[model samples]
Target chain A: MRKLTLPTVLLFIALALTTLSNAQDNIWTPETHMKVKRIGGTAISPDGEYVAYVVTSPVMEGEKSEYLSQIWVAAADGSFNLQYTRGEKSNNSPAFSPDGKQLAFISQRAEKPQVYMMRLMGGEPEHWVSPIPTSSL
Target chain B: MGWSYGGYMTSFVVTRTDRFRAASMGAGLPNLVSMVTTTDISDYLVAHMGGEFWDDYDTYEKHSAIYHFKNVVTPTQVIHGQNDVRVPFTQGQEFYEALKRKGVDTEMIVYPRTPHGPREPKFLMDVSERIAVWFEKYLEE
Candidate 1:
């Protein structure tokens, strides 16, 4: 029978401690979960060359956390991707026009959500419709 | 197209305009009246609708996309999580059935064991790919 040495025992203990530390570092916590970006609300362009989608992530304000969603466009062939909207407010529900020249979506830049349209080629989003106020509904 | 509140907006917008060639509604509530009754967040919906469904049926019906289904001309694709209690799977069904009855092009895709949003990576990819295919089929110039 072989006897274990003191240095070998210490080495085993050191390895176990390192493994435990690594496990703690990789642990999944609620804060980690909140930081994950969520992708959703996909809209395909009329020509099927591009796809519009929403990406939402948690925005931390002091101790409070809120989600901010923005629109993103990606080519069907995976050649390019770009963020379509920016800022703190949320923008979502993208719809491509029949001609695929314009994209419409809902934005909460004001007190209520309203439809906004923008040319796919370029330019700022034009506020298109405000169907009904939330208070009225 | 969108999911949850986005889905509701997509469903509502299609009923109001025909400018869009195609739309994909995910976990959307087309019928606010039925949504209040079946959704897990009934109180939230009722509050948003301004009152209980029984107390203000007219308001609920007016806001519901189902009431305006006759005005919808755009081909729509409905997607839902089968086990979704948030919006409920029937919401998608109602929209799909209305489109079918109206002789409009429509299809419904239900993901089994999914909740309000797809958690499985494969299901998520399927949704993105399907939406692209659906639009191509209807929007080809």
Candidate 2:
């Protein structure tokens, strides 16, 4: 509605350029990638009440970095979010049983990746099976 | 059922069981011996496979799908990236060749200059379509 003003236009252009330059400077970096929490696997409960997923975060392992993943459960309606598993090594590849009473996941705690099962109600995770090369072959 | 390691899993399961009618393997490490030498994660393979290929031939041979390709009957669609350094295109090439030679229904789709994961939209679409067609052709029967 106002008359053409060169100074006002130049000020707006300068502000836009500064915002663009700031965005360009915030490029993706290793630090940012490390901070990203990766969802390795996810499965919805049969009843559709909760969702099980694996959340992995990068951790400094001496000079190197490694992913430490654990299974987590979240309410379908976003009411609650809780960590379900713990300990060293990674616990990933979550799969909910058809009845939704059990959750199975793979872990490297036994040196080789093995399937472990847990009842959603409560209790310690039990090692269901270790289908390693030696056992399978 | 999987990609990469899952790709390897699909390949392995088909050999042991014919329950799966078809499979889509993406950037999979089929041959552990070649993988240890060719992949960007050579040290990881070497450590996990337990020593170098020369030092542990049994471990490499036992795990390598190339060694067991003769037993695989399920039709497989191997989707790979030409520039995949982690699991080289040669892995997919080898599996496709073996399956073809064995008279198994198989196909290989290599996305040009693509990395481990297909980045280009066109390549991704092509891969998904190819997989769908492969499954439709094999499973629908």
Candidate 3:
């Protein structure tokens, strides 16, 4: 068995410290801090021109508890500010058809996630499913 | 759809690591894949689509997809991770090796230290670019 000299002990400690520092250098740091807890409605248009996503905010009980959400659209450059849906109903999961003419999304207007479709040009939404059921959604 | 097997697609763990924690996070770092077990066990899958290996005499000699790979007309590409948790890189490596041995033009990319989602943007881009190149080279031809 080899003797545990003071220098050998110090060398081991130094090596451990160096390894820890290297690990810290490689650790990930957030590029941006998003306020929203969960982000839904990640949709890329068929033409790949626009991306629409929703930012949801919770509601408090006895104070109307409105399901609030904002539908945001941005160019491939992540610009072009627009809110397609801004209302009491929480909106999410914007889907575009292959042609990119039509858009579909989910809403919590009826205390459930009901599929709603609206034309890209401009029009009222048409409800496809009634009384949508989702457990953890 | 026949209503059966309560343990089919209905099964999924929100976090994969929680399900197979024993595998350890980096047992296979660059690869993270696991196909949920089909509800039906051995007998059902084999009878329906045939097994990977067969016991019949003539069928053994028959050119098939899994074994008699030479019969494959479709151009194939194999991808594996240095550390794959579920399906494991070995499986992909073996498939690619077999195709190579048969003198088939196949490509493979073994990503290092990544899981299913590939959180890193560059890695994701690499995967997409690799797939695009493969499709462009094979499909266009």
Top model number, lDDT = 1
Model 1 C-alpha lDDT per residue in residues A64-91, reported as the tens digit of each score = 3457899999999999999999988999
Provide all candidates' interface root-mean-square deviations: 10.7, 12.8, 13.7
Whose TM-score is greatest here? 1
Using lDDT as the measure, name the better of candidate 2 and candidate 3: 2
Q: Chain A in model 3: its TM-score?
A: 0.59
> How many Å off is the CA of A29 in candidate 3?
20
**Which segments of candidate 3 are over 4 A away from where they belong?**
A1-38, A58-67, A135-137, B1-141
Q: Clashes in each model (backbone N, CA, C under 3 Å)?
A: 0, 0, 7
lDDT of each: 0.88, 0.82, 0.52
Tens digit per residue, CA lDDT, model 3, B1-141: 000121111111101112321111111111111121211233543454354334443442232223344443334455545655444555456546655677756666777775432434445445555655666775565
For residues A18-103, write the lDDT of model 2, one tens digit per residue: 99999988865444545567786889999999999999776665643455889999999999999998887888888988888999
